[model samples]
Each structure stands twice: as structure tokens, then as C-alpha cells.
Target: MTDARDPIVRIEGVTKAFGSFTALHEMNLSIASGEFVTFLGPSGCGKSTTLRILGGFETPNTGRVILDGQDVTALPPNKRNVNMVFQDYALFPNMTVRRNIAFGLELKGMGKAAIAARISELASFLELTAYLDRRPDQLSGGQRQRVALARALAPDPALLLLDEPLGALDAKLRGQVQVELKAIQRRTNKTFFFVTHDQEEALTMSDRIVVMNKGRIEQDGTPEDLYFRPASRFVAEFIGETNLLTGQAIGRDQDVTGFDWQGNRLRAIASPGVGATATTASLRPERVQVAQERPGTDNAVQGRVVNRLFKGHRMLLDVAVGNTVIQAYTDTDRGRAIEDGPVWLGWNANSLTLLAD
Candidate 1:
């Protein structure tokens, strides 16, 4: 068994460049064994490039790739003890599900009996026993995805790299597969390095999220950490729907920091190194409570509801506070009652996060 304390993959000062364009810059990350670390970012943001480097499909222009404390920078894909599942579901069209999954084992020179047993085990685990004889053309998108996963996992590699494996599935199926995938990861205790631009998917599946932007890692933390305590404005804005209020840190008291935004005073959780100059505070829409009467909170603002959107369980309202519009969420009843009139929005000081602008 792999040691829990040891990181399975160590990316040390890795940088990638394509001629004049740099794709990744001095990237350093350590992924522990059995971690579900998702590389999240928009397209052309080097998430895929990082994954490729790890999988040995693309080598870094500088620095080393280490696996289980061994430097593997010069290793090829087949020699790296890693497998990747692509967004395209890269299955052989003519091969049966069983055959597709067994191909890797066969190439590894596993005996026929061992290959059969491995395939049977994986098929049962993935609930693909019934569809083992079917071709990729006969399977649904989710089923094909499961087969692809089975193929990747068949080798029982030390690391599994998934590059948006659920991108091909429909929304409902994608959600279902995400739950299943996490369950499988927990059961197998294998390190998963997933790459995707979908923030929701990253939040739902990752043990830790690495948010990348423009060839660098903006932030790396748990979903709650990234959402509730974002390190930068890009992280706060990229992770979810948030209101970034531009302000200046006036002073600090205990754990709370005071801010001045457009002649309004606000308070938020304080951290070290926050400058006195202009900063931004990220407030989640759900954290902003709306009511007809002013609620008892340290910070409360009055504004007219400029726009409202019904989202089944909750309603999203855009409350115009001066020239800036603050987004708030409330239950359907309260949202419907407020309509287009004036409303009171309140939030505790702890709910606000002071971020570098």
C-alpha cells in the first residue's frame, strides 16, 4: 500500500513553452497519494498542458516530474505508471467493451486468465457486466465513459489522469457519473488528477482544486477554501457567482478589517499583508440576506430590486446600491413578495472576504 503521507506526484518548477509562447510557468505542485486534485481553468489556460506533462505526453521545457519520489521527467507515457482518459472517450469503435478494457493488460503481457479476471472485476465494479459484449457504438455516452474509465483503471496505475472525461455526457448523466467517479476513487484509493474548466464539476469532485490562469496557478485549496476564502480577485470571480465591491482597507480591529467603498463603511474578516490601498471584497449572493425590513447585522444596505430571476428553490435578485448592483438570493416566497420595490440586504462581517484587487 502507498503511504498516505507521501505525495505521489511532485511537479517541481515545471515550465512549458511552445516556441515564443509559454504555456506553463514555474509550476510547482505536490499531490498526495489517493488525492482527487482537479486542475480547473478556462480554455488556453495551461490546465491541459499541465496534465499532458504529468502523463508524459508532453515534457516540460524546464524542471522535473517526479512520481513517488522518483524523477520521471524523461519517462514516456507507457513507462510512467499512469493512464489518461480523454474527453473524447477514446475507445476503439470495433472492439467489444471487454476487449477495449483488456487491451492495456494484453499489451502489458498479462496472461489471458489474469486479463479475464481483471476485466471481470472492473466490469462488475463499474456496473458494466451486462454491456461487456457491446461495442462502443451500441453504448450510451455514460456507458462509453465508464468503459474508458475501466480501460484506464485496468492497469491499476499509480496515478489516473482524467482530462474532462465527463465533457461528452449530457448534464444529468454528467452529474450521475461524477458521483459514481468519486465513489470509485474512494473505493480504489488511487490518486486522480482531473483537468476541467467546469467549476461546478471541480467543486463537486475534487479533494483539492488547483485554479489555473494564464500559465500559472492562481489558487490551490479545498472547494470551501476557494469559495469562502479566495486568495485573489480572479479566484473569487472564477469559482462562483460573487459580488466584488471595490474598497480601501481603512483599519483593522481584532479579526475584522474595516473598508471604505464609495463612502460606505464595511467590515470583513482580516488577514495579514492586506494593504491600506484599494482592495476588493467578495460576497456570495446567498450570503446576502434580503428582507422587506432591515435585518440586524453589522452591514446592511438598502437598494431597489432592478432584476429578479427565479431559480426554482431560490431567487436571484440584482439590488442596485448606488451605481453598483449587488446580487442577492432569497427563497421564492420572499423574492416574489419583494418584486421591484426597495429591499434591505444584510450580511454579517464574517461573511465578507477581503481580497487583493
Candidate 2:
């Protein structure tokens, strides 16, 4: 059993460079045992590079990688206790699902019966028992991905690295697989290090999320932490839909910090060193309540509804406040009642996050 309190993987001041370009800049991260940690960022943000280094496919230019209690920075791919599930579902084309899953066990020279048992166990766990005899080309994308997962999990490695493993599936299939993957992780109780550029995927699947930008870790926290209390402007904008308003911090009263935006006074949660500094407030679209009459809130703004988009259960309204546009979401009935006209948007102080500019 994996110890939840122990650090399964510790990346200490790791840096990677490709000639003049630096891919990772003194990156430091610690992943707990049996935790589902996702490295989230856009392309060229060093998420994949970090995964590659962890998998022993690429050597870091500096620092050390400690797996469990030992330093495995210099270890080769085969010598390390980590397995990777690639984006393309890298399964042998000629082999059946059974053979594909048993490939690693066969290499380890396990008894034929033992290898068969392992494959059977993994297939059953991943819901692939029905497709055990099928080839890679004969199965659907989701099935093939499951087979690939079974192959990786058959050897029972200490950590599983998933590099955009669901990138090939369609939107609906991807959602289905995501739930299955999380269930499988819980059932196996193994450390998972997932890398992806999709923010929703990261939020939905991670125990903790490490958001990267320009080869550096911008923020690392739970999905709720990143969404509700973003540390930086990049994190505020990257993690989800948010309205950013640039203002000058005027003063503070206990836990409330006041800011001056365009001629309006706005208050947010207390900010450290907020007095006299330029600050930005991040408000989620759903947090802003829209109505014809002014609502009871710490802050209220009057604006003209520029556009309204019906999104099934909810309606998205683009309201223009001064020169900036604020996006707000409301129930379909309430939204249609106040469509394309002047409206008042209000939000409580707790909903507004004050960020350093």
C-alpha cells in the first residue's frame, strides 16, 4: 500500500535547456504518494518536458529527481519504476490486447500463467475483458486507450505518467474516459502524474494542479484554490472564465480592500501590500448576478447588455461597463426576461479576488 503522507516524487531545482532555449527553469515540485497530480499548461510551457525527464527519456540540465527516497536523476527509462501512457496509445499493431498487456511481464521473464493472470486482472479492472482478443485496429479509440492503460498498469509501477492520453478521443468520449480513469486510479491506489493543456480536464481530474507558463510553475493548488483564489493574473485568466478589472488600490478596512476602477469603487478580499499599488480584481462570470433593479451586494455596476448567448441551461450576457466588457451568466428564464437592455450586475466582496498587478 502507498503511504499518503510520503513524497513519492520530488523534483528539486530541475532545469532543462535545449541549446539557447531553456525549457524548464529551476523547477521544484513534490507529489504525494497515491495523489492524482496534473501538470497543466499550454504548449511549450515545459509540462511535457518535465514528464519526459521524469520518465527518463530526457536528462535534466541541472538538479535532481528523487523517486520515493532515492535519487533517480541519472537512471535510464528501463531502470526507473515509472511507466508512461502516451497520447497515441502506443500499442503493438500486430498483437492482441492480451499480448500487448503482457508484453512487459514477458520481458521480465515471468511465468506464462503469472503473466496471463496479471493481464486478466488489468483487463477486468479497466473493463477490457470483452476486448482481450481484439487487435488495436479492431477496437474503438476509447478501447485502444484502455488497452494501453492496462498494458502500463500490468507491471504495477510506483508511478503512472499520462501524457495527454485522452487527446485522441472526442469530447463526449473524453469525458467518459476521464471519469473511468479517475475511478481506475482510485481502485489501483497508485501515484498518477498527468500532463495536459486543457484546463477543464485538469480541474476535473486532479487532486492538485500545477499550472505552468513559459517553462515556470505559475501556481500550484487544488482546483477550487486556483479557481476561487488565484495567485496571479495569469492564473486568474488561465484556469477558467473570469472578468478582470484593472484598478488602483485605495485603502483597506479589515478583510476588505478597496480599489478605484474607472470612477467606481470596488471592494475585494484583503490584499497584502494593496495600499497605493495598482491591483486587478478577478470575478467569475457566474458570480455576477444580473437584474433590472439594483441587487443587494457590496458592488453593483450599471451596464448595457451588448450580446446574449443562450447556452442551454444558462445564458451568457456580455455587458459593457465603461470601456471594459464584463461577462455574466444567469438562468435562462431570468436572462430572457432582461435581454438586450440596460441592466445592473452585482457581486459580493467575497466573490471578487484582488490580484497584484
Candidate 3:
């Protein structure tokens, strides 16, 4: 793995416009070599635009793009030392698997024997050794994807770009291939710039995530940081399931603040420079505890049972208090015979996160 500060690709004040509308603002970011970074968001959040800019498919209207200390802003896609895997797995229908994997090497003027050797090496690594002579149409979706990946890696590019590469796979196969892709990246020590709209996929595979909205970055951090310490309400609501508590600041100190929601009062620890005037709080579903008896805390509240869902390993409870709904997660092993009899909801001091902006 590469150090986070040692950037291999840097974008400075990069902006893109489509005639009148701006697709990307003056954005700036850095991706380290050998880092598995993902650009994650909903559709039309400029995630695809950023990927296209990095892949040399689109030029930014302003600012520069640097790759490995070299300026590549005006370079065409073929000149940039990067490879991209598309969502459709663009394989040659007439070529065999071996030829598809060796196509890049052939284009680079490598000897036929060397190309064959490299193709064999890559096929073995991807466990496609037995399907070398089969065409893409003769192989399964996962096999064709592996062949596409092998072809992209044959040239040993400095960066690999994946644009929803696994979107075409079935859900069960997608999960299986995610494990395989992570393993391949680890074994090869390659830098990956992946784009995906699936939040769970981003959380599962990325070393760091950049969440974008409206052509600008909303939050950039590790999965744990985004999940546990969201910097804004947009991040708190977008990255995961969160119960928003409308509250008003009651008291403030250097490192703590008190908030009042309805008749419930809660204290949350904040940074030294943070203020107590925050108007909202983000409570994660896992942080809320549900029980038949109260835990004797200042954060406890009384709510009526609106719905209960029994998942395989956990139970999801939706409780309504006034106009607000609180979601609580209870493990299945915690006894399920309690019914809807007087539910008590509580969360610890650390679970309450103040949100602003």
C-alpha cells in the first residue's frame, strides 16, 4: 500500500461544463499509488465525469491533471499510461480468450512468444487457464470479465480505471467477484480508481471513498470515518441509514454540547472548536438500543411500535415518537418474544452526533 500523502494522480481546480451547465466545479483531489480508492455517489453526481477526466476521455475546462509527476491534461486516451475496464466488458467477439488477453501486448509491438507468455501468466492468476481457446460468447459473464481484466493488465499501466465494471453481474456473482477483484488488486499492488453508485460495494472494496453531490465533493474519508463521524448532514444521510433528530442547543462548553429534542435532552461530545448551536443530530440505526425496560439514561425516550421486521440474524424495529420515527436494531439472539409491549429506546452519549451545514 502507498502512503496517503504520496499522490500518484492529482487534479487541481478541475472543472467541466456542458455548454451551459457545469458537470464538475473547481474540484481538487489526490490519489495515492497502490491505493484502492472509489468515487461513490448517486447517478449524475459527477463521479463518471471525474473518472472520464482521469481516463483521458474528457478534458477539464479549467485546471490541470497530473499523473506520476507528468502533466497529462491535453494528452489523448491512448497516450496516458492507464487502462480502463468498462461495464459492458467490451471483448472482441471473434477473438479467443488468449488473444483477447494479449491484444494490448500485441499493440505494444511485443514479440509473439512474449505475448503468449504474458497471456499465460495473467490467465493463470485469474484462474482462466482452461478457457484460453474459448471465445467471449462461449464463456460465462464472470469468465468474460476476468478476460477483460487480464487484457487491461497485460500492459502493466500505472493506473486502472473501473467504470461500474461489475454492474452486469448477478447479485450473488457480484459478491463473489468483489472478493476476487480485491484479492487481485492486493496481489498486483495496482492503483485502482473505481466508480460506483452502490454504497455497500464502495464500503466493502475501497480503502478510501469520495462521496460527491451536485458536481462537488460532499465527503472524502475511509468507510469508518464516513459511517462514524460524518462531517455534514448530506454525508450523514447519504452514506448510510441515519435517524435525524431535530433539536435545539441548550448548553455549550469547550468539548461538549447539550441538545433538546421535544422533551428529550442529550449531551454529545464535540471537538474543542465546535459550537453548540447545531440544529440537528444524526443517530445511526445500530447505535439505538431497544428493550422492554429502560437503561436509566438521559437519552431514553418512549415510542409506539410502528413496525417490526425479522431479518435472519437481526430484527429491525420502527418506533414512532410524536412525528419522528426511530429505527433500532436488535440482534436475533436477544430474545424475540417481547412483542410490542412498552418499548424503551436509548443510545449512548457517543452515539449522538451533532450535524451542521
Candidate 4:
């Protein structure tokens, strides 16, 4: 029996390059069984390259690929217990959903009876029972995506690599599929190695996200951990919208640091890797509360509303405080912040996360 706690996949010292340009550095990461991990980054950030390496489409210049405790660096895609679902799904045009799913099983030399049973099981599991006999052309984008997933999962691979599987769907369908994919991963308990540049997709579907940049892993942690407690400036800005405040540290008390931003005294908790003399912090727009009356918080600042954008339930206000402009997203009914209107921005000390220079 496989222990779910043990790392089923481990990429150790993996490095890949094309000619003089190196793509992946000495990357090392371990993924536990049944965990959903996402390689999230922009284009040319080595996320796709890393996924290709795992699927045997690209060979690493140096490193070992471990699958289920065995070093499979030399193994081909077929030899390794790994399957990939691509952006286009790559489903066969001539075959029905049944044959498409059974293709991998038949390649494994499974009997007809076993393949049929597996197909039935997966069709029901993926809600494709009604479309099992349809060809790829007859199905919708979401249906085709499900078919591709069923086909990939039919092999019962130890790991599934999804390369932007929802990229083909429309915006609304993409969001819907994100939730479905996450639910399917949870239901199947299959370890997923997902690669996508869509931050929202990564945030919504991943149990953990590995933020990559410049051919290297920038930050690796849970969604909340990376979003709320980023370890670096790259992570703070990449994961979501943030206000990178440049300030001077005047003093410290425990984990909290007294910060001076445009002469506004603010208190923020310092994160690891933040030097004592560092002058930067990451504050989310939603953390800034706007009101006419000054909030009784440890940190407060006065500003004039320079711009306001109505976004359904909330409003985004650009407030100008002296020479600095701070963006704050508050409830639509919180207070009226019109252009050139005086507004008070307040937040607790814990809202600011100090960034390391």
C-alpha cells in the first residue's frame, strides 16, 4: 500500500537549458501522494519546461526524476506511470469517448472486459456517462476536457500532469472547470502536477502553488501562505494585486516594526528574510479601509480620493496622500469616496507584511 504522506514525486537538482540560455536552475521539490501541486508562473518562466521534463518530452541537463520512490530520470513517457492532459486535450478525432479513454488501457495490454469496466467507472466518475459514445467533434469544450481527463485518468497513473487544461474554455467555462477540476482531484485522490500562468486558477485549484520566475522557483507554499505571507517582492506582486510601500524602519517591538512611509508612522510585522533596515512592505488594497472618520487602529493615514472605480460589491479608490497614492478596495456602501474628496485610510498593524529588499 502506498503511504499518502510520503512524497510520490521528487525533482532533485533538475536543470535544463537550450544552447546558452538556461531554463531551469538546480530545482529540488518533493510532492506527496494525492496532493495537488501547481507550477505557476508567466511564460518562459520554466513552468512548462518543468512539466515537460516530468512527462519525458524534454530531458533535463542535470537532475533525477523520482516517481514513487524510484529514480525514473532515464525512463520514457510510456515507461513512467505519468500521463498528461494538454491545453488542447489532444483527443483523437476518429475515436469515440470510450475508445479514447480505453486507448491507454489497451496499450497496457489490459483485457477487453477490464477496459470496459474501467471505462464505465471513469465515465460515471467524470459525469461523461451520457456522452461516452460521442466523438470529440460532437462534444463541447468542457465535455472534451472531461473526456481528456477520463482518458488520462483511465491509465491510473501515479501522477497526472495538466498543462493549462482549461485554457481552451471561455472565461465563464474556465472558471467553472477550475472548480470541477479541483473537485475531481479531491474525489480521485490522484496526485496532480498542474502548470498554468493563470494566478486565479492556481489559487483556486491548488493545494499548494510553486511560484516560478526567471527559470527558478520563487516561492513554494499554500495559497494563503503565498498570498498573505509572501517571502519576497516577486511573490508579493506576482500572486495578486498589492501595494508595495517603500518606507524606512525607525524601530521594532517584537515582530512588529515601526515604519515611516512618507512621514506617516505605520507599524507592520516583519517577515523572514526582511532585514532590520529594509524599507519595503506589501499591503493589499482590500486591507485599506476608507471612511470619513479616522479608524481607531494602530495605523492610519489621511488622503484625498483621486479616483474611484465601481466593481460590483466593492469599490476601488485611488487615494492620494501627499506625494504617495494608495489604492484601497472597500465595500461599496462603506463610504462615498468621490474624486478630490477627503478620505481617511486606516488598517491594523498586522495588515502590513514587511518585504525584504
Note the Cα lDDT for every prediction shown: 0.91, 0.91, 0.87, 0.91
Can you tell me which runs of candidate 1 are displaced by over 4 Å?
Answer: 270-273
Q: Compose the digit string of candidate 4's lDDT tens values, residues 246-279.
A: 9888888888899999988899987777778878
What are the per-model numbers of colliding residue pairs?
A: 0, 0, 0, 0
Model 4 spans with C-alpha error above 4 angstroms: 335-340
What is candidate 1's CA lDDT for residue 329? 87
- Span of 10 residues, lowest total lDDT, candidate 4: 331-340
Report how far off residue 163 is in candidate 3 (Å): 0.2
- What lDDT is reached at residue 74 by model 4? 84
Once superposed on the true structure, which residue ranges of model 2 sit more than 4 Å away at CA? 270-276
In model 2, what are the clashing residue pairs, if there are any?
A: none
Every model's TM-score: 0.96, 0.96, 0.94, 0.97
- Model 4 lDDT, full chain set: 0.91
Model 1 TM-score, 2 decimals? 0.96
Worst 10 residues of 1 by lDDT: 269-278
User: What global local distance difference test value does model 2 have?
Assistant: 0.91
Better of 2 and 3 by lDDT: 2
RMSD of 4: 1.4
Clashes of 4: 0
lDDT of 3 by residue, 83-194 (tens): 9999998999999998888888888899999998898899889999999999999998889889999999999988999999999999999998998898899999889999
Error of 3 at 291 (Å): 1.7
- Residue 293 Cα positional deviation in candidate 4, in Å, after optimal superposition: 1.6
